[model samples]
Each structure stands twice: as structure tokens, then as C-alpha cells.
Target: MDEDTTLLALSAIAHRSRLAIFRLLVAVGPRGLPAKEISAQLGIVPSSLSFHLKDMSRANLVSRSREGTFIYYSAALDAIHGAIDFLTENCLAGAAGNPSSR
Candidate 1:
């Protein structure tokens, strides 16, 4: 991921409610959860949940689809993995020693 994308994703998930929502969606896998279900499970109001979902979508951290009248939201696994890779791309490159071998 580029710096801007990484920053956006990080910022989107930086909030407590958004983090919780992301975790829940990740746990549920690609099948996802409907908006009502998500709001109910997280104890969040529908309007607040809508705002969080929009933010996450803008950051490309989450995706949504519609089935019938329900809108299901899922964690964007590829984007998430990309962010993780970006964060750890050069991990421990100049450490004092091989910490893993210690």
C-alpha cells in the first residue's frame, strides 16, 4: 500500500468503535454481517454505525454489498493484509542482534 492509503486505513481503524467493527467483520469472514446485525451486536445506533461504515469504506478497509434490502459489510481482507505487509515490510532490519534467535 502507498503511504496515503496506509494512513487512511490506519486512521479509519484508529477509533475504538471502528476497530471493534473491523474485528467483528474479520471474524465473520467474507460472508459478512448485515448493517442491522452489526449495529445490534456492537450496541451501536444505526446512524452512528452508518457513519463508521462510510469512513471505513472510504479508507478501503471495508466493503459492502446489498442483498434484498439488507446491506452486508465485510472487512476488506486484501487491503488489511496489504496494510500489515506495509507496516512490517522491513521489520527488525537493523536490530542490535537476532532477537528471534536469542
Candidate 2:
């Protein structure tokens, strides 16, 4: 992803509620969780969950699909992986061959 997209994603996750929701979705895997189930699991109110999910969706961190009557939210794996890559791209820069730090 581009820098702007990465920043947006990072900004979206900087909030406590959003971070928690993202982490929960990550733990749950691609099958995802319904909004109510997510709220129950995270001890969050439905309205609050809706707010956080909206932010996450804007950042492309989470996606929702209508499965009958329930809207299930899943982490966008590509966005998550891109964020991780952006953060770690320069890890231990200039020390790739250094063994002592290992």
C-alpha cells in the first residue's frame, strides 16, 4: 500500500476501541464475527461497535458481508499484511548480517 493508505490504516487503529476490535477480528480469522457477537466478546455496546467498525471499514482494515440477516466482519488480510510490512520493512536496518543482535 502507499504511504497515505498506510497512514490512514494506522490512524484508524490508533484508537483503543478500534485496536481491540481489529485484534479480535485477527484472532477470529477470516470466518469473522457478527457485530453482536463482537460486542459480546469485547464487552462493547452495539452502537460503539458500529462506530469502530465504520472506521475500520474506511481504513480497509475490516470488511463486512451480509450473510442472511447478520453482517459478519472480517479483517482484510491484505491490508493487515501491508500494515505489518510497512512497520517492519526497515527493522534492524543496516544490520542484516549482524549475528550478535540475534
Candidate 3:
């Protein structure tokens, strides 16, 4: 991912609620979970969860789909991996046997 995208994803996950939400979605797998279920599981209010989901979706860190009356949300694997790579990109920058620097 590019710098801007990485920054957006990081900012989106910087909050405790959002982090928990992301982890919850990841644990749920690609099948995803309905918005109501997510809010209930995370102890978040529906309105707050809606705000969080919107921010995450804007960052491309999460995706949403509608199934009949349910709005399902899923963690975007590529975005998660991109954030991880962004954090570890410079790992062991000056250390030996760091394979990462290679």
C-alpha cells in the first residue's frame, strides 16, 4: 500500500474500540458479521459502531455488504497486511542477521 493508505489504516485502528472491532472481524473470518452482532459483541453502541465502521471503510481496512436486512462487515486482509508491512518495513535497519534489511 502507499503511504497515504497506510496512514489512514493506522489512524483507523489507533482507537481501542476500532482495534477491538477489527480483531473481532478478523476472528470471525471472511464470512463476516452483521453490524448489530458486532456492536453487541464489542459492547459498542450502534451509533458509535456505525461511525467506526464508516471510518474503517473509508480507510479501506474494512468492507461492508448488505444481505437482505443485515449489513455485514469484514476485515480487509490486504489492508491489514499492508499496515503490518508498513510497521515492519524498516525492522532491524542497522542490525546484522536481520534478513529484513536485505
Candidate 4:
């Protein structure tokens, strides 16, 4: 992932509610959860959850699909993984004397 994408994903989950939502979705895996289920599980009101979901979707951190009348939201695993890899690329490479060796 590029810097912009990484920043976007990071910013999206920076809020407490958004972070919680993302974690919940990630825990549920690709099967996802319907909006009502997510709100109930997180104790978030429908309007608040809707707002957060919109921000997450805009950041490409989450995606949604319609199943009948329900909208299921899932974490964008690939985007999340890409951001993590980008942020940690070559992590600890320049550490003094290699902590692992100690």
C-alpha cells in the first residue's frame, strides 16, 4: 500500500467507535455482519453506526453488500494487511546489535 492509502486507513480507524467496529468486523471474518447486528453488538445507535460505516467505506477500510434487505459490512482484509505491511516494512532492520540475537 502507498502512503496515502496507509494514512487513510489509519485515520479511519483512529476513532474509538470506528476502531471497535473494525475489530468486530475483522473478528467475524469475510462473512460479515448486518448493520443492525453490528449496532447491537457495539451498543451503537443506528445513526452513529451509519456515520462511522460511511467514513470507513470511504477510506476503503470496510466494504458492504446487500443480502435481501440487510446490508452486511466486512473489513477489507487485503487493504488492512497492505497498510500493516507498508507501515512495518523492514521493521527493526536498523536496530542496534539486533535484539533477537541477545
By lDDT, the best candidate is 4
Candidate 2: worst-modelled 10 consecutive residues by lDDT:
87-96
**lDDT digits (tens) for residues 1-102 of candidate 4:** 888888899899899999999999999999899999999999999999999999999999999999999999999988888888876674534455677733
What are the Cα lDDT values of the candidates? Answer: 0.89, 0.89, 0.89, 0.91
The residue-by-residue lDDT of candidate 2 on 1-102, one tens digit each, is 777888989899999989889889999999899999999999999998999999999999999989999999999979978977876674555456788756
| Deviation from native of the Cα of residue 99 in model 3, angstroms | 14
Model number with the top TM-score: 1
Work out the TM-score per prediction: 0.88, 0.84, 0.86, 0.87
The TM-score obtained by model 4 is 0.87
TM-score of 1: 0.88
Write down the lDDT that model 1 would get.
Answer: 0.89
Worst 10 residues of 4 by lDDT: 88-97
* Model 4 segments more than 4 A misplaced: 90-102
The residue pairs in collision within model 3 are none
**What 10-residue stretch in candidate 1 is worst by lDDT?**
88-97
The alpha-carbon lDDT assigned to residue 70 of candidate 4 equals: 90
lDDT of 1 by residue, 1-102 (tens): 887898899899999999999999999999899989999999999999999999999999899899999889999988878778777764434444677633
- What's the CA error at residue 44 for candidate 3, in Å? 0.4
